[model samples]
Target: MMNKPYVIGIAGSSGSGKTFFLKSFLNHFKSDQVTLISQDDYYIPANTKTREENRLYNFDIPTSINRADFYKDIKQLFEGQTVFREEYTFNNPDLKPQMLEIKPAPILIVEGLFIFHYTEVNELLDYRIFLDADESVALDRRLRRDLIERGYDEEDVMYKWTNHVVPSYQEYLLPHKEECDLVIINNTDDPKVIDEAANKISVELHEKNSTLNII
Candidate 1:
């Protein structure tokens, strides 16, 4: 019988550089050693009402995700089942979504803004990591991403940032941050900081996995 995969939950505010950190961390391991399941892909499709309402949908809220399905998929992974999901394109018509296949591995990483907010999902995490950043810096990063990658206007981005993102972050994410196993502050442009954090985490995870006889 195979040992259950060690599950890690990574949470942070939007534009907190979680993607950049994850990329650096993954470089230390082979493809088969770790598998990542992101909550971004589990967003519920926005209804016609939201589209007609000037696209003011609050995606930053926990209800925007299909939480039941996300939790079910994680349980399936723990049961040694492979799961497949469609990539979410942030309503970008220019980008085509791809079919994502997630295989069970020795280490499973669950990343998102609200992973810690969902009770069932939070309970499954063996380790939790919170990525911290200054509000101004995160907002700037968010603006660039929404403007360049998602093709959003400045007005819309600012509207969402002020009305949606900040509230949700304070209510859901920040409250549980103190309970996390690790906290990484990523407010700087220096790649060396991210590299050092990733290297330390990689070494620790390797040691833990070895002890569990799962690597």
Candidate 2:
């Protein structure tokens, strides 16, 4: 992979503090060196809307997204070519067709629940990370966020997590943690945790490149 961007994936069951870990990684590096792309940003609008309507969507599954769009974004980044990124709308929480400048940075962090399950997404990654978190805690956090942000009631949020998210995480996300460069069991609530991870990431990258040179 000549001139390829160094892609790192941070994954966990929803509410497993994947965001928290990503923020921590960001803290170590300056904005110019690190850019973040999330799988949530590439979701299929129709499926998300259906979930919003009948709440029948399996959000935790990798199939929740349109694979074609996901492949496009990753291919552009993987090839070290610049591309624009679309952000996800929380109000609608649907995928928006959008564009943002993406350049080759020192590190590119991609976080999501299903990052590994998607073969194309995984192929682009140089490093992968998974968070080990308790199911009850993850569910509670999901409930709170859904109620406050999405206007979903407690019952509705619980239904999706139990039916769609949890099962999918077990069946898909869990098995792929082994593919990552590191596995983070998120237990800290401190802001410093991110700093620590970022520093470690830098060191690991250095070590990897050094070994590659030795080859």
Candidate 3:
């Protein structure tokens, strides 16, 4: 592992193509050179809370995550240490200890909604990217993903989108966009856009590494 790993933060409103951008970015390099840590996985497990009550929880809010632990893990990874990453089961509350073993790499990426909300996490980022998309486009994508992948119905998706997602974006996520190193408009399903962004990031990383080597 490299002594100093480069960390990238990809943040966006819910369903704004953060995951897609992350996947496309990862495709630019060898699998072993990059590591991914999703903020979605750092959600605190609802232990005694009933399923219905858990459904009412505003997961989009910063308080919904165990931020301290998440930051600790990220810091560990930055220091070239192995971390037991959490595997969040979106709609499934019964699964215990959603953890996975992850090794350190030269490039580390952490993506999610409210990723920049935590001060410590934000300070650790070498590059920050904010993905932007139309609210309607995001809603449509979120509805489809939740219905097919997360086992949510139309009503539940709409309810959460209207109540939790939009409000949280206005309050927590949107304000941080102005501070991002790059603001990518990702309204379309275009590979070229992703490639361009990833290439730019790769160049920035190469330059940083080269400077360190020269020193």
TM-score of each: 0.95, 0.82, 0.88
Any runs in candidate 3 off by more than 4 Å, and if so which? 47-51, 93-99, 207-215
Best by TM-score: 1
CA lDDT, every model vs. true structure = 0.88, 0.70, 0.80
Q: List, residue by residue over 91-184, the lDDT tens digit for candidate 2.
A: 3544344566766565677777777887777877887788876777777777877888666678778788878877888898899878777776
Error (Å) of candidate 1 at residue 171 is 0.3
For candidate 1, which ten residues in a row score worst on lDDT?
46-55
TM-score for candidate 3, residues paired by index? 0.88
Model 2: number of backbone collisions: 4
Off by over 4 Å in 2: 47-52, 90-99, 206-215
Clashes of each: 0, 4, 1
Report residue 92 deviation for candidate 1 (angstroms). 0.2
| Candidate 1, superposed: residue stretches over 4 Å from native | 47-54
